[model samples]
Target: MTSLVRSIWGEPEERKLLFKIDFFVLSFVCLQYFSNYLDRANLTNAYVSGMKEALGMTGHDFNNVNSMFTVGYTIAQIPQNLLLQVIPARILFPVNTLIWGCLTMVTAAATHVRHLYVIRFFQGMAEASTFVGAHYIMGSWYKDSELGTRGAIFSSSAQIATIFSGVLQGFIQVPLAVFIVSWLQRPSTKNLDQLHGIAGFRWLFIICGLITVPIAIYGFIFFPDTPETTTAKYFTEEVGLAFILFCVP
Candidate 1:
């Protein structure tokens, strides 16, 4: 019984390598997932808060925007995943993240529903790689039994971001209201229907974009591409070789 348990659980060195993989891969992927969801859902918050009125949106404009995003996301899914095979994930993942984050920031400049449709569509294409790509990287590092739990943790990050999105909007509103009233010399935005102040719903997109950009940069610098391709110093040559040999099969 003891021998069986030891064989399944792995030796101490194997456990240590697993921890390292989990810490680096899981943390980066999870943060990226969180930011991705936050960017996706912020539009809803913006619409209800002020963006809909500000853009003169009517009828099914909001739904149309979402549909455009979904269309772009669906279209990119296969190509992006296939591209992942040819490109280094360290480059592909972060570049995709940077593109989406830039598109998210550009949402601040949208003056009409048409503009939103365009931005969201391209943003969707940029983000299409994240979940699948991250899963691929995780699979490269973690064993079959280990993959499920880590994947669950990574997927749950999106839900966590959903919860965090509302709080982030509320938190941003407070400081923005203060800055507008005190520094920008604008009237209190409390009763405004359509956003007239400098710090409108646009800031939500901008802030989310800013937060995502840094994370993307971090991933570019530190995210281990895969066991076979990674050059991160933390994963020494021996560690990398062991992980590839252990997990590749």
Candidate 2:
């Protein structure tokens, strides 16, 4: 089994380094991508679930909010990617993730549709780094043979999050709706409309944000950047040098 695995991957030393890179780099990117999609999916779900009525969203407001997000996303893309040239990926990626997570949480406090517009635009700006940054990091670490599979795995995370979002929203909405209906019928003293002064849709954002922030924190500690400049404790000086030499044409 070990020989077969080594034959498909690389020699023992290379396989050892690859395993570490896969654990630290690939895992972080996939989780970050998953969280990115979760925030986006939650937003659309929130809009349909209750955000429209709660925020008094009028004609074209939702579309405009998405447009604002797109503009911010587009404006930041080049700048963020260029930053990777000077700034370390460990620093840049985690900081960006943290910013977007906070923005996602801030969406819960929005009292007006304009608030959503501002929040989403900045959120987009923060998220602009994730996809391209992941690709760049993967290219830095993986050789041609290994890169394709890792890229596919990373891309699939977004799709998995999309499917999970539907299930998660259903889980959140169904129970809350049923409880509110029961409370309304029973004439309860406590208000069931909002849970602890937060709407269901708002809770969705909060949950997604909560899920995201930890991943950012994890990235800060564990992300290995690239072979040339890695500070990861798991990768020795020799391993980093060997990996760099292997990638050279």
Candidate 3:
């Protein structure tokens, strides 16, 4: 990054474009990370909102949900990584991300207690690629020392999204309820049932889905698959900085 920064800010105009591309690409990368977290965390938000009562979820059931998610997540890591090699990450990752986002929304539709288990298992499968895959992409492009801050920033989006979910859940509850009324014409009445039933869950899922779709598009449109193959159209200088940062480690 230091190399790219000096090249862009101090070097001749001919070298500046790549550095600019690098900056925009990283910016897109970080923002997708933020949305990635938001989808991952909507479960916690759903729990507090009404998934518990609507589905009669016990502590054991919830624990099992997490447990199943963990198992599925762990099981898929190796295969997912292998799949990365077989697939074009720029295509595979974003398309899969959007699919995961859609799955996240469908989770709100779970009616029986067992439904949560099944959905979470699959969600785990979808999300399984994220950690290892992200690092794989990062390591492919970034040098060791330079990866620290970029990785930190990317990782930190999870924490940021978690904290923000609390506030978002609180504020969106009523508005989401109203949205449910309009979208599905569900329950045909106003009450906790209306606000906390399948319609309500659908609304939350739909919201999470909407937010994730654009990030997936950004990944497809803006983020580079690797330093060797960056395709940023407007900022060549930034791309060079990203290349230099990846090279440092």
**Which candidate's TM-score is highest?**
2
The digit string of per-residue lDDT tens for model 3 on 27-141 reads: 6556666776777677777776777888889768878988888888888888887998887778777876787777777776778779878877887777778877887787765
Alpha-carbon lDDT of model 3: 0.68
RMSD of 3: 5.1
Model 1 TM? 0.85
Whole-model lDDT values for every prediction:
0.81, 0.84, 0.68
TM-score of 2: 0.87
TM-score against native, each model? 0.85, 0.87, 0.75
Order of all candidates by TM-score, from best down to worst? Answer: 2, 1, 3
Using lDDT as the measure, which candidate wins? 2
Q: How well is each residue in 12-99 modelled by candidate 1, as lDDT tens digits?
A: 7677777888777898899899999999889998888789988999999999999999999999999999999999988888888889
229 in model 2: Cα distance from truth in Å?
Answer: 0.6
* Model 1 global lDDT (CA atoms, 0 to 1): 0.81
lDDT by residue (138-158, candidate 2, tens digit) is 988888899989999999999
RMSD of each: 4.8, 5.4, 5.1
What C-alpha lDDT, on a 0 to 100 scale, does residue 201 get in candidate 3? 49
